[model samples]
Target: MSKGQQWDVVSGVGITALAVAAARAVETGRPDALIEDPYARGFVGAARAPVKLPTTPAEAEAADGRGYWAQVSTYIAVRTRAFDDYFRQAAEAGVTQAVLLASGLDTRAFRLPWPERTVVYEIDQPLVLDFKLTVLREHGATAGGVHRPVGADLREDWPAALEAAGFDRARPTAWLAEGLLPYLPSEAEESLFHEIHRLSAPGSRLAVEAIGNIPGALADTAANGSVRTLGVDLADLIHTGQRPAPADRLTNLGWNVRTVPATETAAEHGRPLSPAFVERDARYVFADRPPRAIASSAMSSVIRPPV
Candidate 1:
């Protein structure tokens, strides 16, 4: 991927964002929905997707049976619910600041019940952010808290842009990297986390949707299927290679980390996913930095008393 490549809501990586919204819309209509995103369908309706994107369960059923869309819809629902809970838990823990990296078409700031005086920063390409704000504004949506959009490339110096936009590094933050890592090159992924670590304060938390390594054959098959069905070549957009696990990287950076397999999460949510659609190695990684007092106490305990 180029350093400053751009795409709108209907093309490139941007279409994937719309696809997720469509999945959310379908999930919202379920009687036993994991998360309610009333605005998800609106985003889908506004975009002119190159292929038929299902916004309802019936439409989704017609697209493919027990196929790509089926697995994606279920997985997206599970992933959305998991991240939603992560944010809620962070809020309950009194960490009021939040950042959504590559925050495309996600309506959390508008739908999630955030505490008063909370601030949410969304970082993405300028066009992507503009498109999202336009669609939401047309629907007369209001954010639950202070909403700031940082329009900059993640591969560039976004931390400076974030700081300029009043991101408080000293305050505990709840950061999310949902469905973003795969589009980033290996080096860029490393840089992204390093920046996150630098800006995060003690007591901050992070949640990531991490993908496991994909075999070349599987990758080619998936990519070919997507192009044939969706009219978009996902292979061109995705960066595939062996990289360090996000959980291990965060642990080494002094964050308490936990990894949960996507299949396990699906079962826990009572929605078992098909392995064909969901990557066998896909997982969610949640990590939190220790508060300063706890770190200080631990350091003190390790030191012997002066003779």
Candidate 2:
């Protein structure tokens, strides 16, 4: 990916962000869908990118054909539902301040019925944020709570930008880093977690989609097949280098952590495991920072549970 300062709908890693929206739009149309994003289809239509969203069963069949796209759709569906539930659970626990890092065409800020006094800060590229808000406004969709769009790159001084956008770092915050890790280099990924830990107050929570190692042949098929079919090569955009374990890092940072495999998440949601399961290395992680008293207590044991 180019290190350009600007990107629109179809260019660079920004296209992959739209690609995820396309997947979500397809999933929302399914009768037994795991999650629903009412704004996803609109974003797809508005984008200049040739992002294909399967609106009919035949179109879906032709697009997937029991191959890479099929698995990609299934994985995204499961991932979307899991993260949706994570935010809802976090919000219910009275954590009002929320931030969606690398938020690309995500409609949770407008869709989720949040509690009073809730504020959601969405951080993403300037063009990405502008395009999303423009499309959303054209569709006449209203936000569910306070939605703050902080236009800044993750590699830049984003924390300062987020604070300037009215983010209160002093309060307990719920942070979502969905579909962000793989694109970052190993060192940058480390820096991202460290920054998150630095800004997090006691009782803060985090949700992540951790990337794992995939088998060689399966990876090759996905790189060739899924990439061309979707008009976005996620494999090419992502870094395959070894990354520090997210759960381990969070645990060492004095956070209570839980990790779950995508396969288990699929089974729990009654979705079929992707046929390319052998090649896909994906896991969901949830971490919570304990309150001051709990962190100081000797009985503070990290809670590890399968989602």
Candidate 3:
């Protein structure tokens, strides 16, 4: 990863955000949609995309004539639903503070029925957040709760920036890291979780969409030709290599962790994913920090006093 690379809403990794938004727009138009993101189409429409992006299911099918967007759209829809349910569960459990790491064009702050007095912090690049806010404001959209946009690179000192934005480390928070892990180098991914653990209070919750391995299509020239046609090389955007597993890391850090295969989640939602996507061993990881007493006891057991 570059030390200080930057991108806007239509270039580099920023384009990937637009792609996801397009998928969300398609999903929202589905009659059997699991999640409704009304503003997703607006983001896709406002962007000057390098390639024509589909904002409806028919358009998605036509664009997938090469059989790329179909699987990707389904996978993105399933993933979005899973994370939406995660946040809803977190809210129902009375964890009000929420943080979306690398939050790109996500409309959750405006869409989700967050409890009263909830505060949602979105952390991402300055330009990315600025673009999102600009478009949402044009549509006359307002967040359901307190929305704090922390414009800081994830590889840098985002924790301090988040705190400066009125993030309370003492209160339990619901954190989401969707479509973000693969973009970070292995070491940086580790550092991200460590910082999150440090900043989290007891009873904090986390949801991560972890990519277990490089997708086969990206590694195959012929198979990935369809992707390149879209004018963005995902392989170039992501860091590929072995990394610390998020579930294992959080478990060792004293949080109760559960791992669910993406395929299983898709199956549960009655939306089967293509093997091209699931063959990668992608999964969702949910973890919860125990209460203060239980966490302290668990830490003490893991770390004994010096003799």
State which candidate has the highest lDDT: 3
Query: Which ten contiguous residues of candidate 1 have the minimum total lDDT?
Result: 215-224
- Give candidate 2's root-mean-square deviation (CA, Å): 5.9
2 or 3, greater by TM-score: 3
Estimate the TM-score for candidate 3. Answer: 0.93
Report the error of model 1 at residue 113, Å: 0.4
Q: Which residue pairs overlap in candidate 2's backbone?
A: none
What tens-digit string does per-residue lDDT give for candidate 3 at 1-307?
3768788878888887888998899888889997899899999889898888899998988875765676777889999999999999999999989999999999999999998799999998898999999999999999988999999989888999999999999999999999999888777899999999999999999999987866564564237563554568787878778777899999999999999999999999999988778777789999999987847778899999999
What TM-score, to 2 decimals, does candidate 2 have?
A: 0.90
By lDDT: ranked, best first = 3, 1, 2
For 265-287, candidate 1 gives per-residue lDDT tens digits of: 88998999875645546789999
Model 1 clashes, total count: 0
lDDT of 1 at 96: 93
Q: What does each candidate score in C-alpha RMSD?
A: 2.6, 5.9, 3.9
Off by over 4 Å in 3: 215-217, 220-222, 226-229, 294-307
- Local lDDT at 262 for model 3: 94
lDDT of each: 0.86, 0.80, 0.87
Candidate 2 deviant stretches above 4 angstroms: 2-4, 50-56, 64-67, 214-224, 294-307
